[model samples]
Target: MNLRFGLPQPLLSFTLLLVWLMLAGASAGNVVLGLVLAWLLPLFTQGFWPDNPAIHKPWKLVWYVLKVIVDIVVASITVARLVLSFRREPNSAFICYPLTLEHPLGITMLASTISLTPGTVSADISDDYKMLLIHALDVTDDEALMADIHKRYEKPLLELFS
Candidate 1:
């Protein structure tokens, strides 16, 4: 038995524990079961993952998560307002956003973040991974939307996964 088998992937284990606890309701039994599963699942399945991306700056991830949460909240309110106002149709548009970050995980995080926020959904990504398609409920300025995504989401992910 390898010594590292006890904790092959710390982040995955933590996420699995939290998810298990959330779904199973955090009783003592559930906690113990969650811990067991968290430890064992990663150890057993570690071979399937070809590459595990390293976090260059783990602290930045916290800030990035907080920022996304705030954006979700603000977007929820904006979307609610738009929905309530029946007279004006939302300036809906599909945007082709060119991606800059080279890492697949970083691109995935960026797409997930965009989808999590209200009024915007990541529709698709190009085959070459050069562009992402986004559908927005309201998009008055294409350049501004692209720039905002690049600045708020992509930049941090690039730094985090670098």
Candidate 2:
């Protein structure tokens, strides 16, 4: 690891400082506090990050984010419609989704994507990290849900992190 100005993770520190500034505004106190926190956080957490996550296809990340955003919007409408309707009940069910992506970061991204979509939450991951437990608000077709997730989210993540 290259240490610049006594900082182990310069990029992370810079990102943290930028986020702090954006959230707290550009006051003198905020600037000083943000700088201190940014510098200190990387130092404190350096040991926890065993390895830095690598992005094999940075372009895919942009596309993947866009897809997720679209899914979020669509799912939000579906969930809202289900909630407002009184005639039909949501067929809520727990799904044990089999995992294909092996990388921890990839699996984490997949889990996050599932949770980010409305009407679905990633409940837990198996100890061996081979399967994921997901809960959906409504499910007409279980197999279809799993397939869609695999094709849309997991496949891209697998490719991205490979």
Candidate 3:
């Protein structure tokens, strides 16, 4: 049976359900309420969603998430040390990274990931969306920073979205 009522993206529904349950706890009443919200939320908001892309590699996504977590920890330490040192004015920079991933969601994810790391912020995307502008708090080497973003974040997102 087609239960979507036009809500074709079931994963989002499941995630909403799980998030609700986690917040409310997994009591029987919570589970039932969570299920109800999960089912109805998607139906209610289907029009707001664009075409949902299928995730081609779930395993790769898990690995990518782990790598991001590791990077975040490392970057946090690096930023903290830089801040405490107060030994030098940070070599801050705004980097224009040329984009390869054309998907809107992918681009958004890439921007979000960059901003998630310590000492960096995604300032803007180009009007054409062909490039992303990022501000690094302490960039001793622009090329290295660009390479890191290209390899660590952009590549995996391209693989996932494409």
* Number of the predicted model whose lDDT against the real structure is largest: 2
> Which RMSD values do the candidates have, in order?
3.6, 2.5, 3.1
- Order the numbered candidates by TM-score, best leading: 2, 3, 1
Worst 10 residues of 2 by lDDT: 47-56
Candidate 2's C-alpha runs over 4 A off are 2-6, 19-37
lDDT of each: 0.93, 0.94, 0.88
Root mean square deviation (Cα) for candidate 1: 3.6
Question: Candidate 1, 4: how far from true, in Å?
Answer: 2.0
Backbone clash count for every predicted candidate, in the order shown: 0, 0, 0
1-162, model 3: which lDDT tens digit per residue? Answer: 235655456888899989999899999999999988888888887778877677788788888889889989999999999999967888899999999999998899899989999999999998999999999999989999999899999999888987
Instruction: Please give the TM-score that candidate 3 achieves against the real structure.
Output: 0.81
> For model 3, what is the C-alpha lDDT against the true structure?
0.88
| Candidate of highest TM-score | 2
Off by over 4 Å in 3: 1-7, 14-37
